[model samples]
Target: KEKVQAETFIKLVLLYNYRVERIKQFTNVTMGASTKEADIIVYNDDTCTKPHIVIECKNETISELEFLQAINQASAYAYALSGTIKYIWITTKSKNEYFLIDKDNNIKQSIPDIPQFGINKIQKYKYVYGGREQNQEAKKDKIKQQFFELETISEKDLINRFKQAHNSLWEGGKLDPSEAFDELDKLIFCKIWDEKIPRQKGEPYNFQIFKEPLPKNATKEQLLDIENKQTNDLFNRIITLYNQGKKEDPEVFKDNIRLSPQKVKTVVTYLESINLNITDLDSKGKAFETFMGSYFRGDFGQFFTPRNIVKFIVNSLPIDYKDKVLDTSCGSGGFLLYALNKIRLKADVFYKKDEIKHYKYWHDFASNNLFGIEISEKIARTAKMNMILHEAGHTNVISSDGLLQDIEIQKNSGNKEFKYNHFDYIITNPPFGSNVKQSEKPYLENYILGHKNINWLDPSKNECRDNQSTEILFIEQCYNFLKVGGILAIVLPDGILTNSSLQYVRNNIENWFRIIAIVSMPQTAFSPTGAGVKSSVMFLRKWNIQTTDKYKLIKQTLQEQIKKESCLKRKNRVSARSIEQPYPRDAFSN
Candidate 1:
C-alpha cells in the first residue's frame, strides 16, 4: 500500500514537470540529533538546489489520527531540510491534503489540495450578483461591494430585520400570530430560492427579492409600474420553485404565498440581502429555533424542545446508517433531524463520495427510514419544512394523532402494517401532564401497563393499573414500536421516575426492557416554554422473548401449585366433615 502511494506521489510530481527524488535518508546536521526521512522530495533542478516541495505518503486506510501524525512528521522534515520548502503535500492512495508555509516557518493555512506545477488551478470563490452586470469584471466589482454590504450588517441586524417584517404582519392586524409566521416562512423560502437559482445573463441586476430598487431614470408612475411588476415577477418565480419542491417532497410545503404587493415588498426588503443556504446548519437551526421560541411560547410551547437537550439526547444514542428511526411525537422534527445529521456524519467517513448515491443516501433515508408522527397540522407542516431545509425530505412524517396510530398498529398485527416493532430506535419528548383516561377501557385493553394482568413469573398477583398519564402511556408506546434489541430514548417527568406511587410503572418497565441509562435534566429544561416541571431523559433496550421466558415458566409453576393446594384443601374438608353431619356451610363455601 505504501509502495503504491509512493508511486502515485512520484507520478504526480513528474506530471507537474518538477524533478523528483525518493529521499531515503537525511543526515543529522548536529551531533546527538536524530535524522529525518520523507517519502519523496521535488526540487527545481537535479542538483536539489532548493527543495521546492516535500511529500509524505501513507497507506490508503490511514485513520484521521494517523494522518495528523503524518502531518507533524512532514512538517518536521520540511523545517529540517537545508532549503525552505515552498509547500508540503501529504498523500494516501485515495486522498491528499496540502498546507502552505508562512514567513515564520509554520503551517499557515491548508488549501483544497496541492496545485499542479504550472497550471495553478486553485482559485478563491466569490458571491456572484444577479442582473446584466454579470461579466467577470463587473462581478469582481460587485464582490467588493458585497463585502462592504456584509461587513456593515451583523447577524443580529439580520434577525431583527426578519422580526421586523414578521412583526409588521401581526402588529397591524394584517395577520394573526400563526398567519404571520406562515407568511414569514414563505418569504424566507423565497429568499433562499433566490440565492440558489441564478438569474439569466444580460438581465439587469435586480435586488428586488430583498428590496425593490428604484429605476434610475423614470417618472413616478413608471417607477411604480416597474417596481410592482418586478416584485410580482420575483414572487411568481418563487412560487414556481415551491411547486417544484412539492413534487420532490409533497409533505414539505403548503399553500402558495398570498401576500399583497406591499406585504411582499416589506418581507423581501427585510430578508433580501442575506443568504440562508451559505450559513452553517447549526447556526441556522439555533437562530431559527430561538426566533421560533418566542412565537411558539404559548400555544406551541409543548412542541418546542430546546436544541441543547435535543442534541444531548440524540448524541447519547448509538445510531446506524440503515437503522429505522422514529420520533413518534416529533415536535418540529428536532430529534429526527439530529438523528439524520448524526447518521450522515458516520456516512461521511464510512463511504467515499463517488460510492454514495445522493438521492438514496439522503432523500430515501429520510423518506423511508426516518419517521415522525406529529398531531398538530400546523406544527407538522413546520416539521416537514424544517426537514426539507436540512436536506432531509419529510416524506414519512404523518400528521395525525400518535395514540390513534398506535391503536391502529395494535388492531392490525400484519407485518405490512409497518407500524409497531419496526423501528430500530425511538427517540421522543412526548407531551406530559395530560390524561389518557378519557378512553380508559380501550387503553387498558390495548396497553400492557394499562391492564391488570398476571405476573410473568408468578400469576398470583394482579399487575395492572388504570388512569395512566399520557407520558406513562408513551413509555409503553415507545416500547411497542421498538423491535427486540431496539433502543428507546425518551424524556419524561421526574415524578414518574421517583414518586413511590409510580413504582408499578418501573416494575412494568423492567419486565419489558433493560434500563440502559437515565439522565436527570434540570428543572428548567423546559422552563423557556413556561414548563418548570423537572424531567429526565431515559434510555432503554427492548427485551426479547428469550430474556422473559424464565419468568414466564416460574409463573406457570406457581399458578399450578396454587391450584393443587386449593383442590387438596377442599377434598380434605369435604371427606372429613360432610359425611358426619350436614357440613357447616362455611366449610362448603371454603
Candidate 2:
C-alpha cells in the first residue's frame, strides 16, 4: 500500500517536530499462535498520539466486491487502532473520487452528499490555457485563478476552497502537464469523491454474503428461520452444481450451485476477494494493486475511526493510577492506546504532575503498562505500528497468545513477577468460535482440563480431537492470569456467558471474577467478520476464595435470564444445578 509513502509525506510535513519510527509495513501470522512481520511499520517519536494529517488515497469507479474487500482490510486496521489517525482523506486523481474508510464498521456511513466530479469539466479548459506544456508562470497564475472560481461551482461545498487550491500549488502541482494540471489537483482533491456509482440509484441488492442479518431480539423461531433460509440457499446451490457436474469455468455457469453453507459462503467470499475490482488513477496501478492486494489493505486503512463507539468504550471505563492494562486479541491496539491516553490525561488533570513531567511519564509509562496479544501476525504488525504512533514500543506486545506462553518456566521461591500477577485490567475482543483451535503443540495435559504441572495436554475429547475450537482454552487462561482484584471487560460469544455446559468452568472462575455488566452489541458491529456470533461485552473482576458463591451467582443469573427468554425456555436446558454439585475439570462452564 502507498500508506508507507503517504505516511512519509505526512511525516515530512511534520518534520523534526514529530519523529517517524519505522518504514516497513507489519503483519501477524494467524496460525497456531499469532506471529509478526512488517511491510511498513513506523513509530512516531513525538509526544503526539495521532498523525497531524491522515491521508487515504482514493479509488475511482469500484465494484461491490471491492467495497467488501476494502471493508475487511480497513476494519482490521480500525480494530487494531484505538487512537492514531483522525478524519480520513482519500487522495484520488479527480474531483469525484474521495471516500472515507469507516473503521468503526458503522453500517450507516455518511457518503459524500454532492457530485464533485463535475469539475472534470475544467480539464479541457486548461489544455488551451497555455501553448507550451511546461509554462510554469502562465500555468500557475491563470489556471490557479480558474481553479479558484471553478471549485465553488463544481461538485462539493468545500469548507475551504481557496485553501485547497493553495495546497495544490504547495507541491508545485505535478509537473507532468504544466498548464493542464497546475492547479487542477486542487479541484481534483478538494472535490474528492468519485460520483460514477454502481448499484443503480435504487437497484435492489443483497450483500450476497447476507441480505438481512438475524435481527436484534430475534425469536428463537426467527433465528431458526434465518438459519434454515441460509441453509436452504446454500444446499440448493450445491445440489444444482453437483447435478450439473464440474465444468472448466465452474463459477460462471448460470445454473451452477453450491450445496453446503460453508461452501457457498466460501465460494462467494473468495470470489469477492479475487474479483474485487476498483478503478484507481492509472489502470496499471490499479491492476498491480489488486494483483498485490493493495486494494484491501490500502483502501481499508483509509477509513478513520468510528468515533462514537471508540468514545463510548473509552469513556465508559474508568481507570486508576495503579492499573496494568492488557488487551489480548488486540487487533490494532486501539483500546490499549486509548486507555493509555485516558490515564495520562486524567493523571495530568488530577495528579499534580506538571504538564511537562506528566507528558514525559505518560510517554514512558504507557509504553510499559500496555501489553497486547494479537492472533493475526499481519494485524499484530499493524498493531505494533499503531503503538509506535503513540510512541509506545515498550508495551511488551507478544506475537503469541496472551493467554499462554510458548516458552515459559517457573523459578522456585517465585516472587510474583508482574507477569505472574493477574492483570489489573483486560479489555479485548477475543475471537468468537469454538472453531478456533490451538496450533500444533507436542501435547496438552488432560490435567490442565483437570490437573496442572503435567507439561502436556491430552486431545481425547471430541473438541480436543478436532482441535478446531481454540478460544475456550484461552478464555480459561485469561481467568488464570488475572490477580484477585483485577478487572476484565471483554467481548465474547454469548454462548460462553450463559451456556449450562460451561457450568464447570464457571464454578472455577466465578470466585475469581465477578460479573459487572454486559453491553449487548449489534450484529453489524463487525460486519466484516460476518459471524455475528451473538457477541456481548462482559465485564468482571477477579476475586479470591468464595468460588461457590460466585458459581451460584453465575448460575442464578443464567437461570433468571433464561426465564425471561421466550425461545429457549422449552428447549432442553443445560442443568446448572445438577443432582450433585459439579467439579472443575469434570465440566466446562463460564
Candidate 3:
C-alpha cells in the first residue's frame, strides 16, 4: 500500500531547508517521451515550471529492485521536462539518493546529497535512519569536497588493477582464454551499471563484492567460499540490471555472464574498489586498452592499433554530428570512441551553457549513428564494453567478419540496417601482414577482389581466387559500406601502395575512390602490436557516379580537340585508357 503522498516526503525533505514556495507536486506534466505523472517537481523560482530538482517518492520499505526502477523513472521524468533541471532526487522516509545532470546530459548518480537553496551550496544529510540534518554550512562543504574526491582514482593504478585482474584469470585454469575475457567483460559491464543504480539504505554498493570485511585469519578455503558467494550475488544483481537495461533499450548489452563461481571470484577481488563508469575517459581507455593489448597480441595484434595513430587519423577527418560513422574491423573500438569524443567537443563549444538541451543529439548519435564490426567474439565484447564506457551503446557492433557482411545480414534478416550502404564514414586498421587466408566459399564469392579476375567490371567471371588476405578484401568492403561521396580513413600496408604485384588493389581503389591524402605512419607505430610493417593512413572519398557525367562531358571536349589538332592530339588518341587515366589526376587533387 502507498503509505505517504509524494508531498509528504518533500515537506519532510526539501521544505526542511529549501524555500517552500519553490517546490510543487505538479500534476500531469507532459514534457518527456511519454505522458506520465511526475511525483514531485521542484522549481528554482515561483514560476514552478522552471524545474530545478525533480523527486520521485516511494514508501520507505521498498525493495532494492523497485528502488532502482524508480530511479530510471525519475531519470526519464527529468529528461522529459524542460532542460533546466540540474538535479534529480529519489527519497523515502528511510532512503535518500541524489544525482547531478551535467551540461551534456550525463547523469552522474549517487552524489553525496542534494544541492542547497543557493547556487553551489550542497545540502548534507546523514543517510542514517532517524538521524537529524547537519546545520553547519561548513560541514556541508566538507562532505561536498569528499564527494568530489571520489573520482580521483589514479590512471596508472587503474591500469595496473585491470592488469592484475586479467592476470588472475589467465593464471588460473578456470576458463579458456577467450572465455575468460568475455566473462570478465560481463562483470565489468555489470560493475558500471551497479554504480549508477540506486540501492536500499542497508544494501551494499553494487560493485563492492563483499558485504562485510573478511577476517584476516580466514583460511584459503574460507576466503574462497566468501569470494564465491559474493561474486555470485554480485553477478546475479548485474544480470537483473542488465536485463532491465536491455528492456529499456533493446540493444544495450548482447551476451549473458557465463563465468564459473570460482573464476568470477578471482576477477571481482581485483576490481572491487575501481569504478569503471566514473573514471576519466582517457584513464578508462588507457586501462582497458592496456589490458586488451596484453591479451590480443601475437595472433590478433592488428586489433590493438596504437591510440595515438587512431587519434591522428580521426582528427584528420572532418566529422560532424550528422554523419553516421563505422569501423568495419573495429578491434576494441578506438576509432568510434575518438569520433564520439569529437562530436562531444563540438557540442561543448557550440551549445556552451545550454549544451544539456542538445545533449540528447550527441547521445543519440553515439548509440544509434556510430557503428562497428569485429570478427573475434572476445574482442567484439571488449569493443562493446569500451563503447559503453564512452557513453555509447554497442548494439551496432556486429561480431562477424568484416567481409561476411552480406551473409550476416541475410541471417539477421530482422535487423534491416545490418546490411551494407548505411554508413557515411569508415575508419579502420585492418589485419595486415598476418597472411590469414579466407577459404569459405560463400564469403569468398561476395568479395570483388577475392577473385583473380583483373577486371571487376567483367561480371561474367565467377572464378574465386585462392588465398586472399582479409586486409585486401576489407578495402572493397569499406567501399561497399560508404554512401556516395562518403569518406574513408584506413590504415594500409606500404606494400599495397608501392608493390607492383598489388597494383591491382590500388587500381580497384583508384576506380572506386578519389584519394584525398596519404600520410605515412612510422614503422614503429604498430610495433607494439607485433606489426613492424610499414603502413600509412589514407584519406579518400568514394567517387560519386554523378561526377562521371561531368567526366563524360570532358571526354567529349577532349575528343573534339583531338579532331581539331590532328598533329598534336593524334599521338594521344581518344581511347578508354586516354579518357579515364588523365582526367582523374588533373580533376582531383593529390
Q: Per model, how many backbone clashes are there?
A: 7, 59, 1
Error of 2 at 196 (Å): 43
**What are the runs in model 1 whose C-alpha is more than 4 Å off?**
1-133, 137-161, 172-174, 193-241, 256-258, 347-368, 406-418, 437-445, 452-467, 552-590
| Model 3 spans > 4 angstroms off | 1-152, 172-178, 200-203, 209-263, 297-299, 353-355, 405-407, 433-439, 453-462, 546-590
- By TM-score: ranked, best first: 3, 1, 2
**Residues 1-590 of candidate 1: C-alpha lDDT, one tens digit per residue:** 56745576565655343434523323232213765556777665556657656778877545545766988888777777766566777765434556654424243344433444543333221124532243334434422221101112344544455566677667656478888887777666655655566555433222244223333444557655655765677666656766765565455566767777666655554454455666655555555666776777766889988889999988988887678998879978889988888866766676664565633565566767888888777788778767755767566776766665565633432223347788999999999898766355454546666665477544455644646677888888888889999999999999998999788688778777889989998888898788899999889999997776765576567768998998999999988886877756798574
Predicted structure 1: lDDT: 0.66
Instruction: List, residue by residue over 98-168, the lDDT tens digit for candidate 3.
Output: 67655353434334455655546442322221122223323455333111112236676676656555555
Clashing pairs in 1: 131-204, 131-205, 132-203, 210-268, 210-272, 452-464, 457-555
Give the winner by lDDT. Answer: 3
Top candidate by TM-score: 3
Candidate 2: stretches off by over 4 Å: 1-311, 351-354, 406-418, 434-439, 442-468, 545-590
**What's each prediction's TM-score?**
0.60, 0.40, 0.62
lDDT of 2 by residue, 1-590 (tens): 35434544463334212234422234342333554332222233244343222333334233323434544443344334445432222322222111223343332221221111111112211112112332333345433312111111211212122223222333333322222122222122111111111333222112122323535555556655765675466445444434332242121122322123543343333121111112221232222222222212323331112224444676777776466777767765667767776877776675566567665666656755677766544455445544543445433654554444432412211212335455777776666553433345423332143322223233223233324234555555566656777777766666766899665545555555677877887866554433446667777877664764666677778866876784465443444344356666847766
